[model samples]
Structures are given as C-alpha cells and as structure tokens.
Target: MCGGPSAVVQVVHVTSLRINNYGYLERMVPASPSTWMATFTRVVAQAAAGFRRSRRLFHPWGECFAGTITLLVPGTLGIREEYPCLVRLSKGLGFVGAVPDALGLAIRIERPQPWDVLMVSSAGTGVLGRLIITPSALWTRPCYSTLMPYQRADGELMWLHARALGGHTVSVRRNALTEAIKGAPLGFELLSGASNGAVHWVGELTLERTAEPGLSFDPGVNQVEYLRLYPGWLTAIRSSAYLGSRQSRGATLSD
Candidate 1:
C-alpha cells in the first residue's frame, strides 16, 4: 500500500508492477496489432464506418468539457500545481447511446506546451484485468489506466491511473456524463506507479462544465515537448489512428 495523501515517493522504473497487492512481473508491452501497417489502415477505415463516417475511430461520440487537473505527485510526475484543462469523456469502441463500453477520459492540460493524458477503463489490478480493456457499466468510483507505460522526462517508466471519487456514480448513456455533473463536479484521483510496489498519488482531476463541442484531442501530436508514450510501437499505432480519424472527419484542433 502507499502512504498518506500528502506522501511523496522516490520514483524509479523496474521490471514489474503489483496491482492490489499482486506482484506482477513487468511483461513486454504490445504496441501494435499483427502486421500493424496494413492492418491499421484497414482498422481505421472500419472504425470510420463504425462511427458513422464522421466520428473518431474509438471514442467517436464524446462531449468535451472544461476543467482542471491538479498534479501533485512531486518527483515522479515532476511537480504539483493546478492546471486549466479540457476534458473529453467518451465510450471506447465508438458505441452510441446507453451501453457498456471502455470509458475513455482524454485530458489536455493547458500550457504553452500542453500535456495530453488518455486513459481507458480497466481494472488496473490483476494481470489479465490490467492488460485487457473492459467496458464499464457505470462511471462512479471506477478505475482507469494508461494500459501501457510511459517514460517520464527522466527516462523512468510509469503508468498513469485515475479513479472517480466516491459517491460520484453516473450512467453510461449518451450525454449523461456531463449531465450528472451539472451541479457536482466529476472528480478523479490521479495516480502514478502501481500498488504492488510504490504508488504515488498525483492529485485530483475535476471536470465541471460541458463546453461547446468541436475539439479533437490528439495525444501523439499535442504533448509536452518530449513526453515519450513508451513502447514505441504503440505510439506509432496511436499516431496513425489519430491522424486517420482527423483526416477522414475533416476535423481540426480546438480548445
């Protein structure tokens, strides 16, 4: 287990991650599918069709919101401060209406050189649970993970995690995400590292308002100068997906 909310951890990269007390030896992180290039092209086209031709490949139908993410894990995540941000809450697999799907949270911290954090619903606990993507039925008190590792600016590998604060449950229906938080803010506990070893509580991510839509978040392109989304192959796949989606939809970046 980790220390108190105010505790600071000395972060380092090792060959394993322990989720919920289970010591899991780190395994090779897969970045792309088999025969990725040709396969990826076909996947993008299929995704476009799956999303009704004008939506993103995965989180095609999402509502963008304005909020802030307070980063406070210190050494591992760099520093602590509240940053103005834009958040898009969506369902993975491009499913429409009320349905179980991998809940996606894409956050873009506003800065001269902003940082994009893309997380999907996952157990973030057991080996299989952490590796496989799961569609969450509810949004309250749920766990989300990077599903892969990223190298900190200092070259330390770590995974970013988030959890909805207690008593914040909401439905999975279309537009229910922003609706449920009209009066109460949708909050998350930002974390770094894994529980089996040393988990650092980064801070809170609070999404409060439903803003006017039309923002496309491309994590591969809009990231802090040199933030490395590690396991190079995955980055390539992600880059291709994001690029293809935007090109197909004729979308542009927005705040």
Candidate 2:
C-alpha cells in the first residue's frame, strides 16, 4: 500500500508504456536465434553456389594456408619456440568480387601450445579506432589486428598486430593478395602494444601453404599462454557466436 490505488494505476501505466516500447523495438529489429541460423545457412549456400556470399558471420573467406610461427623474442612464460600453424585469410562480409569488405586473418598454432589468433584489418590504433576502421585499408603490407586486448609480460594490456615482411601485399584474390602468398614463402611478424604505445616484436610467422591439413582452428578452443582475451559483453557475444559457428560446421573443441 505504498501509494494505494493511485500508485497501482501509475505502475500499470508505466508497464503498459514499457510493453509498447518493446513492441516497437520488435518491429524495428526482428532478431532471433532462428533468424540468425537461417541467415547463416543462406550465406553458406550462396558461397557454395559461387555467389561470393560468405558463410561466416564475419571474416567468411574459407581459403586457409599452413605455416610456422616462431617466437623471435621471449613471449609469455619466457618461451621461445616454433609452433606449426595455419592461417586463414578472409573477407569480413560475404560481399561479391572486389567489393569493399573487412579483411581478416585467423591463425591457429598447434603443438607446444594450441591457440588461435584472429586478426581484422584496421587503419587507426586504440580500442575505439580499431572498431571504427573498415576493411578498405587492408592489404599485404598493412597490419591486421586481433581487436581484443592481451596482457603483456609486465602485466600491461596490449593488442596484437601482424604485418607482412619484405613489403609484400596480402591483397585479395583477383587483386593480388592471393597471388602474393600463393607460391614462395611469405613472412609475417607478430607485435604487441597499445594503438599508440611502443611496439614490441613477439614472434615471426612464415606461411608456405604447402603443408597438409591436420587440425582445425578456433579461437575459443584452447587457452593462449600469456595473451588474454578481452573480457565482458563483447567477448561473451563473440565466444557464443564462434561456438555456434564451429558446432554448425561440425568442429569440436578439445579439452
């Protein structure tokens, strides 16, 4: 009886307004799990039909190449070792030939440690700018980023960056990126730091694309040594989306 009948009427009115607001939102954004799944299926079929539609929600290019990643400097746990790896180059969206789409590079390291690094092309540095830059700035010479932050040896937060060596361009197929990395060995370096901070080289990665296929790559599969995945809402959404995609593709997460 905080406010008696008058209070109850006010509460009812407030509830009605909230319900109406939700109804409006529902009309504006008809988002649902089933809707998302349907979209995924459609994209897959489109890509299969050679329509240039990407199966992945983001970074859908399916062409993967194998390589080796070597720690040039001591990384987390002071370990300097070489790990067999696979790198997948893709477009963020399922856009048709030569159309603008975010570019991506996903790396999976096996043996000695099993972890995945997903990088997206960006122009500016820092947390906010990283998300703002589109795929237009991507090429073989420019750097790609993981977007998520990692913890450094000294406990400082850092972002990961990868760049092609010898001034080579990692352009898209029909453009030049595919040809550039097709034959001869391509070299890349992994660096750590903030968008505007001092950059530190963590390792060197080489791609050959001649290795046989073995294991699948997923960032949510295993834990990386010192690299920390970004925390909170966005990370949670990303993890769920990744798991869903893997499951749909019949990929398993190892223990």
Local distance difference test, each candidate: 0.69, 0.61
Off by over 4 Å in 1: 1-43, 50-54, 73-79, 125-128, 194-197, 225-227
TM-score of each: 0.74, 0.67
Clashes of 1: 4
- Once fitted onto the true fold, the runs of candidate 2 whose alpha carbons sit more than 4 angstroms away are 1-54, 72-79, 124-129, 174-178, 210-216, 232-234, 253-255
Residue 32, model 2: lDDT of 58
lDDT of 1: 0.69
Candidate 2 lDDT tens digits, 68-110? 9987544347668888887776766655566666777778888
- Per-residue lDDT for 8 in model 2? 32
Best by lDDT: 1
After TM-score superposition, the amount by which residue 23's alpha carbon in candidate 1 deviates from its true location, in angstroms, is: 52
Provide backbone clash counts, one per model: 4, 4
